[model samples]
Target: MTSSSSDRPLLGRRSLLGLGLGLGLGASFALAACGDPGQAGTGGSAAGGTLKWGWALPTSWDPVFSSAGWDVHSLSLVYAGLTKLDEQGTAVPALASAWKFSTDGTSVTFTLRPGLTFSDGSPLDAAAVKKSLDRGRTEAKSLVAPQLTSVREVSAPDAQTVLLELSRPDYQIPNLLAGKTGMIVNPKAFESDAAGLATRPAGAGPFTLTSYTQNAKAVLRRNPAYWDASAIKLENFEVHPLPDAATVVAGLQSGQFDVAQIPGSQVAAAKAAGLEVQVIPSLVVAVLDVNVEKAPFDNPKVVEALKFAIDREALLKTQLFGYGEVNHQPFPKGYVGYDPASADLYRYDPAKARALLTEAGHPDGVDLTLTTTAAQGLPEQLQAQLKEVGIRATIDVVPAAQATQIVYIQHAKALFTDQFAGRDSAAQAFQVLFGEQGLMNPGRRTPPELAAAVEQVSRTPLDSPEYPKVLRAATALAVRTMPNTFLYSVPRLLARRKSVSPVPAFTAVQRFEGVTAS
Candidate 1:
């Protein structure tokens, strides 16, 4: 059964430390309690030293302005969100000690933990929370704002209490609060120049931002006055950007790094070397984006032909090394609203693909230019497979730095890219990528049905059993329309030195509060 967002209770500042009493039980138990700040690092040995982490993307310290790269990991260290997800994807409290929903489900109220202060020794209260959230809404044109769009206003009823009034009854508001985009900041430190503060940050998380150099490295120091300092054992941490996969593997082998993100093909080799390998299935999917507003793709038959020509099963087994799940629908498995029956939309048949091409006036096959990036999983191999099917497909392998620009800015016709649906709600996924106002909408046109469905889902209450039904119907329509041919969800792989004692469970999002180097 899918887990509900409101099942878990919020953890207050003092109560979190009390949870540490259950540490050292076992790895399973340790991962389960990771959301509780007091219970964080219970199963790991305390080793006070620097921890070096490596990834392919460089660090962009600013949370609001930056979309991709290592900004999420960097901001995670310095800022805390109102709510956080546990191993099972349940929402638990972080900055807010406890929260509750009104009987109508249109509003939520949070009680703050007294004495909590920012890294710069500023008081963390209801007013500060309002400032941080307001900035994200105004500056970034944040996708996260939609979750709060229903919120009519935010008011501090008392010194410790915050109340949010919404225009509609919705249950996923707390889940949205748990996302990285919702991490809180101090008004005192950033009120002067919100845009300028992207380079320098001040928050009440476990770590403090010491220095950041664009495209180089991000350095962090443990917050000495952090409310949960006892749970954070690492004195210093460094995240270095290594764009080349080979270089990342070499760094791991040469002992230049303790933890590094290895490609799926290199997982076996890393395990053979006796490194602690943790592979977490990600919610990311590789899709072939067609410009619906342009000619050719504007025809549904051409889009249907493209969908059937590619074999999803082959991509899942060969390219992903059986580390992915086949998906024709936009919603991935484990999502609360997913319907397995939607897989019937696309069946692999090369003969049928050629027949459809003929029907579309391309007898032999269509000559199309396909664009993809090396950063996406198995793009080169996927390009070769498409060529075998009689489609005169030419692959344009662009650099990772230029890929987003080529797709979003340059408006390239047929590009390969990966998108993530961090929330289980289908409305959240659809509204972000396919909706008329969505940032990634290539067609630049919003389907009326999709727009109406998104509106319905947004207004539905969490306790209503029909919520899943509404999401399933909307997803089915989206898949049949072929907005972008849905692909398999990618797994997230994390490697750590075996000596590190405390490790959190690998879920949709990677949590670091419980990790410790022994």
Candidate 2:
């Protein structure tokens, strides 16, 4: 039966109050109250000092339109996602207090918490939630809205209640919500043309955007009227964009920056300098993407040959400086439903590669161009490795700004790229890179089995008995197809000052709320 929108229940004042209290508790105590080391309750440990952080990308304040890496740090300070993943990679409630899924799993009901307000003192309720989501759906330029295609309709039963009707069952919906694209915004602050507001953003997070300068630095201050102001430690946060690795390392060592993201090669040096180094293994994989429709790669044998030619083990050890894990497929090892059996497909064999190349009508050798970006970690090393196996490779390094659209969007022939698959879920990773109409599916075609598996896995309930089995099979099939050659999973290295206490477990996400300056 098609459920009527009127069937949804109105959110109550008590429920909103409870939600407000819960949020207040979460913001104030979830990280510190857990009895973590170097952490204290309520008042900050640093006694109200400014903390500076650094990264390798320019600062962009727009959460919706901006795709820059450093911009995420700035946006995160102002915005909050509907849900967040815990250390174990499980999706937990964030903005939404709790949610209930229908038996068929086609619908989801979210009960809103009370007394939630935006940074600008505007009310945040079910109607506001609907407006924020609807804007993403209708806006073509929004990177986030595309991920919510499964959402057929959103209804507000009352001021604090939200009901979502999906076209199909989606167990990974929560993970999507935890992503940057799922950050909630005040409907009143949203502008259809967000270009002007990209410099200044408004949201309901622990911190507020105070000032920003593109490609230089961004400054954030504690929200005085924040729902949970007691939990915030440092009075202000300064995020500096230093694209150079040396500059980031120097900043962290000199104590100019309290926290910094250093390149993998610099991890050992930073650790030697007596800084707290938290090495979180990233879900990101460096891959050699081929345009299946384009010439040369159209031949399956050539694709197989290219896969066999590259040495993933050597790349992981030497090129990555042993900071990453060698992966045989898109899904990394240790992820839920990852198939150990699939490792055999990626075995290094130069002789077999030569044979495959000869069979693909390139007997002597194949001359192909390899396009990569300079900031992509180890593309040059990959090019040199490909050359040893009789393939003449020419490296074309493009700027990081234009690489995504030029390589993935434009379907450049042989591009070297890296993709960070945030969570360890097969459904989320597969959908992002290989689903029929996925954003990164440069091949632009889906295999029948892969399509069926993705659909089945997407509909499986989070707690279903068949969930793990179906996920394993789907991942195995994707590996065999070789849509993109999986190389390795990079390790995310964080250099933080020793005085900061209460560090959360290293997951794909790094949350600053849990941190307290001493």
Candidate 3:
């Protein structure tokens, strides 16, 4: 068949990618943008004016029902979470000030800040927090439901206290609540105008989303009524969908964008243009997931063989401009679940890949596709590397917004590349990536060994000395059995005008609460 976005697969539901480039919403967000924060753009200028930041626009503005994990950043502008994560991946205060776990370890209580109100002038009390979290677990088609399954019940003991009762002794609640699952929705808006919320803000966050234009920009103004309004340094905060690399750098130089997320490849270009750059070690990892129910890859030997074909170090060095670390497991280094044994399990060897492919009944060769987003040079390099080992991989580039729907939900592609925006907790990441309902698992079934190992992790307390061992055991089983292949851990390369101060670093998505300018 001809290689096109509409072409039939040489590899059915078992394979996906070809350089068949199509443009729409995905084209505008080649995931890079440019402009000097020194020059102001449009309605506002720099720090005290408007922080014209280039990042991404969310598929859904509402947190409870948002599809993509990266949407947490956009959603955070309008809604406040029960807790927020710090640079160390520890849960700190947001709306909830202090929390304590019960003596039995099965229950935990959160103390909400006194007199907090939503932007819509509704009280953000304990009952509202309970309702929001309950919807996270029970809402139809909720993306966060899987991450919150351990919590069997949620109740508000008093106006200021919210309690969660777990099915077991899971001690990762605080961390798990750091992102979308932990965001507290305003109950009044859901009751009055739920549909309106898809475009507007109701929650008590730092900024109230004023205007959102699709595939273009989200215009937000600081909320004067915010609980900690003084922390918001900018009068306005605008986020645009980062476009092509050239367009991004051009925009930055022209003062069209103040702060933009540029590719690692463009750091030198940005720096030479008199812009400032910061390479923050982030939890973002790229994964190659396969459908084990299909041919070639369906065989265990071939599955293992493909592992040898990936040159993680080379990919890191070439594609990332040496700004990333080679990783074989989902968890990045310093994470408790990061396993050294898993990292040492696989290495790049084309001859070994070829030998294993021949042994698995493919002496001639194997042809497949390597699907990815519009991240310019990486997919082509992967395609070249795979070809050397007799795996001719076509490149398929999907749009950022539609990736989760087409690959993970519909399972249309046999094997696809996924860029994971790391979760708040290890268990949360495991549930979302390896569980039956995990977004990464198109197979939708966890093996018995993996299930048992993960269960041991869930039952163990997060602070327990043995927690890391149990979590590692689960990760190790997944690495050996699952068809999902982890490539590397890459940092988010951010560039700003000299006027802007250094952006705060967080484990997962970034928040603009502390970003300031001269």
lDDT-wise, the better of 1 and 2 is: 2
Q: Per-residue CA lDDT of candidate 1, range 398-477, in tens?
A: 76556665666566655455554434334556655676655456676777887777677666654467776776777776
TM-score of every candidate relative to the true structure: 0.85, 0.86, 0.87
Off by over 4 Å in 1: 1-5, 8-47, 56-59, 140-148, 224-230, 375-377, 421-426
Better of 2 and 3 by TM-score: 3
Q: Which candidate is the best by TM-score?
A: 3
- RMSD of each predicted structure: 8.6, 9.0, 9.7
| lDDT by residue for model 3 (1-518), tens | 00111211000000122111122343221211211222221214233667888887766667766666767777877777777766666666778887777776788888887877776566789999888888889988676787788899999989999999988877677777877778888888776776555655567777777666667888777665566666677877888887678778888888778888898779999999999998877778878878766666778788888889989888898978888788888877877778888886779988999999999899978877666776457788788888888888778888855676677768777677767756777777776678887767777778988988888876766566787788888889989888888888878788898887788876566777667755
Q: Which candidate has the highest lDDT of all?
A: 3
lDDT values for all models = 0.62, 0.64, 0.73
Candidate 1's TM-score: 0.85
Query: Which portions of model 2 miss their true places by more than 4 Å?
Result: 1-47, 56-60, 68-74, 191-193, 224-231, 375-377, 423-426
| Ranking of candidates on lDDT, top first | 3, 2, 1
